[model samples]
Structure formats: structure tokens, C-alpha cells
Target: MMKKAPTPRTALAPGIAKVLKQLHCPLDVMLMCVRWYVAYGLSLRNLAEMMAEPWIEVHHSTVYRWDMKLLPVLEKAFRLRKRPAGKSWRMDEMHIRVNGEWRYLYRAVDKNGNTVDFLRRAHRDKVAARRYFEKAIEAIDADRETPIKIRRCKYLNNLVEQNFRVIKRRTRPMPGFRNFRCARILLAGIELMPMIAKGQMQCAHGTHPSADDQFYDLVT
Candidate 1:
């Protein structure tokens, strides 16, 4: 007898397989919930309610758990295949409330407005700025021997500032994040959404890839 084709679960990447081990939900459904949560301005309750329309029984907290578990895995996969950023960079910070206190979200984009990288920190001091710069350089897979020049003019930073509005709009509806860890995971996913939409990921699909295709490419 011929062997049966490998099941979707069996075909998943080892990292995804490990994270999803023992989960009762179908893989597509779980991924759908995670995608909708980060790609749109919907809360967990909103996602749970939406799923009920299709008769999928899932609790908001379950979705939250999925976010915490799967997002890091997904983000790591995306980073490996991410396209390099442009040389001219713009960086800035946005204020986000977490656990009833303010936190700094440092973000940067290239001149073309592609996302470079992001970091969340408690303080907006020089150390935090330095760390963000380091992270962005690493994210772009830059050559360590080449020095990167940073432009400090206020007018030159509008590209990243505009990018910040997209993130803020998505985060506004939810109640503030419960803690820093939760905020970090969710924010990374949130940052990831636009990058996918803009086709910043290198995939088999040519220049423009639909967000869904890119997301599945990362996970599977």
C-alpha cells in the first residue's frame, strides 16, 4: 500500500510543531485567530465572538495564550526571510501604556518607510536609543564593518512618525496591555503585520505577496 500524504500538522516546521503540540484546535483556525488579532483592531473578545459566527468555539483567553505562544515563533521565522532595509534610516519613539504606566516604543524605518526594527523600554534615555539602533542594524543583516550614519533632523523623521500612526491606531481600541511581557509579544506581532502587507518578506511569490500567503510561508 502507498503511504498516505503527510498531514498538515506533521508537515509544520519543527518550531511550529513544538509550540502547537497537544493543542486541540485545527491549525488553520488557530492561525486565523492569531492573524486577525494582530492584523486588525480587534480585541480578544471580539475575535472569540467572530469565531462563534462560524460555530468555532474558542474563548478570548485561549486566543491570548495562542498569541503568547505562537507569535515569537512566527516572528523568528519572518526575521530570517525579511528583506534588507534601505540605508537611510529614520527613528523615533511612541508612548504606549502598559500595566498602568508609560513605556517607550522605539521604532525605525528606512527612507522608503519600510520597518527597520522596534524595541520597547522603560526609559527613553540615550541607552535605550543606542540599543534600538543596534537592534535595527542587526535586523537588516548589516555588515558589521560598515558604519551606519544617522540623520537627526526633525524633518527627516516624518516617515517613521507616519509609520507610528499605523501602530497606534491598531492599539487604541484594546485596554492597555496587562504587563510588559504581554505588551512585547503582541507589539512584535503588530509590527510584523505591516511588514507582511508591504511585502517586506522575501518569499517565492515575486515582488508583492498577499499577507495570508506570507504568513503561512513563515509558519509552515
Candidate 2:
């Protein structure tokens, strides 16, 4: 017997719809355009230029507005997906300087280099640790299919530290955020790109296409 060929994936077929509805552009087109802007550090104008494949012309401001509008929706959808978490868990805390005032940023990453979750808190004491642990555990419990082992070695926690740098590097170029509310929203989108790159988040997984494949598939 002959095997059936796979169906062609298209923007209108099915995608991140909570965020992609009623838009003038196709689903994948808007997603990939935003993805490239984050993944390549491309300016909005640069991304707009690239969007002109044949006749469609997009402006940078349009892309900017799309990001501000869709990023939170994307983040919300991302959190609801079922993803695998490593059995070995590593946790860490770092000092975040916002407006010269210190804040505690707690993070946990699984052995597979997937970020479990992150939070910004005001303290690093036992109470803080306990609260942070509870929060991270909630996310881990939601995703992991098996039992998890907490690795006590500080060095092992380096995995989460690396994840921290992923966001830090992206935010470094900006001058500073006016407030935590603004900062949090911006970081939601920035951190999302790496998550996208890791194949940890998507609208559908039956085909299990990588994030890049979906985004590029939309553009072309």
C-alpha cells in the first residue's frame, strides 16, 4: 500500500488564533514577521522591507503595533501548551536592578534547558524561596509527565542562569523601562522568542513542526 502525502500547511488553515484573528494579513505572515523581528534583532523597518516579497508592502509601525497587541496573547497561549520538562530540575535567583532599586528574580530550568517558569519578587529569604518554589512547581506540575528530582548542586542551576542571560541580552540594548508593568510586558515578548526557538510553544503539535518552520512557512 502507498502512504498518503502530508497536507500542505497554510496561514488560513489553523494557527495561533486567539491572537491571529480578523487581521488583514495571513496568520503565519504576521507571526513570522514578528518572529524575525525578535529572533534576528531586526529593526521594524528592516522587517517591513523584508515583507515585500512581491507586491505587499508593510510599514515598520504596523509591525510595532502588531507586537504590542499580539505579544501578550501569544504569551498566554504559550503557557497553556503541554510540554516536556526534564526530570532533573535546577533553580536559581538573581538580582535585577530596575531604576537602581534591587529586585529578586527567581527562575527554574529543567535539565533539557527548557525554562520551567520565572518570577520577579522582592526578597530572597526563606519565605521568598518557598513562594517562588511553589509558583515554579505549579508550572512544572502542569507540564511534566513523570516525577521530578531536584538537583541540589548550585552548579547544576547554571541552566537557569543561562536562560536569564537570554532575556538580559535582549533587554540590555534598551535604555530603561519606566515601570515594572511596562518592563514585564516587554519582557514577555522578548523571552517568548527563545521559547519559540526551543520548540516549546505552538498553536498545534500534530505535525510537530518547529517554530522556525511555521514562521517561514507563513512568509513563503
On lDDT, the leading prediction is 1
User: What's each prediction's TM-score?
Assistant: 0.90, 0.64
Off by over 4 Å in 2: 1-30, 43-62, 94-104, 122-126, 138-152, 202-208, 213-220
lDDT of 2 by residue, 1-220 (tens): 3112112353332334434454566554567666666666566777788778655688887887677666666566567662656566677777766665666666667778887666666556656775667766677668768644443576776778787887777655555555565456666677666776787764454777666664343322
Against the true structure, candidate 1 has what lDDT?
0.84
**Native-to-model Cα distance after best TM-score fit, residue 175 in candidate 1, in Å:** 0.2
Clashing residue pairs in candidate 2 (N, C-alpha, C atoms within 3 angstroms): none
Candidates' lDDT values, in order?
0.84, 0.63
Q: Give the clash count for model 2.
A: 0
Q: Once model 1 is optimally superposed onto the true structure by TM-score, how far is the C-alpha of residue 32 displaced, in angstroms?
A: 0.5
Q: In lDDT terms, how accurate is model 2?
A: 0.63
